[model samples]
Target: MPNPAHATGTDLLVLHALRCVGFAGLARVSEAVGLPEPDVESELIDLAVAGLVTRVPGDFGGWGLTEAGRAADAERIRDELDTAGVRTAVTRAYEDFLVLNPELLDLCTAWQMRSVDGVIAPNDHTDPGYDSRVLERFADFHRRADAVCAELSAALLRFQRYRDRLADALARARSGALDYVVDDMGSYHTVWFQLHEDLLATLGIPRH
Candidate 1:
């Protein structure tokens, strides 16, 4: 499939991802864009050559946007929002997204780790009852997330991809792909993270 991030002919998606996530590995970038690692690496190289982004070499380091890249992304994303005439709508949707953000994080945490004996511990999936409860909450969370995605798609068509991706993640989780809940690259938390980035970028809102 063609890259949805580049369908609009702008690198704002990748640039803003770096802006929000700080620095990240190529695997993360590829997961976020639903593209292969090589494709994301190619784009990262081009951005680096243009002095808009930089690659950090270290065990814990990866790619990050330059100051210039951040500025460019802000300008371009703002312009795109204005051009689409969806600033007001997207802003409103973002407010709604914020309300759901904490709960979503809670779900992710519950999925990856469980509260046991008043201490947060990794969920080893030993207790069927606990797993079922978490899965139930996840299903409920998806219902609310659907509304946010709907509002976003209404504002900008490109935002529709998030709805599909998020649903796919949840579906995988339900189908016993436990990693899809959080740990895996295409997990529910990952898709939600990208949607959060998309909302901030579309509204030209800074992540402080």
Candidate 2:
């Protein structure tokens, strides 16, 4: 299927993705926005030229927004929320997300480690029944999470990308790549963190 993101401006996509992800390389930024690296890198260069973002060099180096970029994004995000008049909608969805957040963390922990004889050790996946139970719970959680995504997407088009990414994470997890749940680049937890960041940024709320 053709991507609906084409209608949205790539510049804003790259800029806002930087706002959400923070200090990511070209590849990471591309994954966040579900855009091709060439397209995303082109926009990043344009943003750099405008003094909105800067690149760092090191083993941990990546792209990050400048002070000016953060300020600009704050203003733009506020305007976008007010213009769409969805502050209440988005805020309510955020509340729902918070409730799901802890559950997801617990589910991921269960997937990664198991308790045996009062000892918490890494799950060796030798127990198929245990693993199957965790996957079932994950599937059920994804259903509830998708509902929240739908509400947010109706409020802001950019939010559609999160829904897409989250679905991909869950899909890969179901296909026997368990890392997609919490360990991989596009892991369910990774997308959830970015989505949470996007919500806070859009609402002008500070992280607590």
Candidate 3:
């Protein structure tokens, strides 16, 4: 059996990152894979040479997977899960994630909007008390989320990045960096969404 902590290198990491994150620049790709830009760029170049990915030009341009890349990612990821004998473990983790998914969505909504004068209004972060309450709930939520992430990372090491990124975002938000909660690119909600995408992609499940 293959090792559970598979070091697939940038080969599958970069390709599968694009598969899950969609079209993204070098920086976003690097962030997704927890690797340096130069390393990701080199992998992207090699993938492009193999006709698995392509870099688009102009504004809003970025690296995206080709149809071949998508097919390849699906095949390889399935093989990896089966070879590692962790498909059932990962599937259980994914099910646990689904249970937590709704609570997370509710938390994001609470962070972005609040009831004011009996009317729903966008959160302005001007109310310290309200913000503190939300942060408290987030801290509570993170404790449960961390458990699920631990289970996932045990089955597949690459999933550890999500655990790390999610914790970092929450830590920053607790430290008063409000944007880390939902606004920034590496925000808690953003990483959660990517993890959702990654799970779907790995399981070969179509997004609804």
Q: Write the per-residue lDDT of candidate 3 for residues 47-128, one digit (tens) a residue.
A: 9999999999988999999999999999999898888788888889999999999999999999999988899999998899
- Give candidates' CA RMSD values in order: 4.3, 3.4, 1.8
The TM-score that candidate 1 achieves is 0.79
On lDDT, the candidate that comes out on top is: 3
Q: What's the distance in Å from true for residue 184, model 3?
A: 1.3
The models' CA-based lDDT, in order, is: 0.79, 0.88, 0.91
- For all predicted structures, in order, the TM-scores are 0.79, 0.90, 0.95
Report the C-alpha lDDT of model 2 over 58-116, residue by residue, as the tens digit.
98899999999999888887887776677888899999988999998899899989999
Q: Give the best candidate by TM-score.
A: 3
Q: Output the worst ten-in-a-row residue range by lDDT, candidate 3.
A: 1-10
Clashing pairs in 2: none
Residue-level error in angstroms, candidate 1, position 184: 3.0
Off by over 4 Å in 1: 1-7, 57-61, 112-124
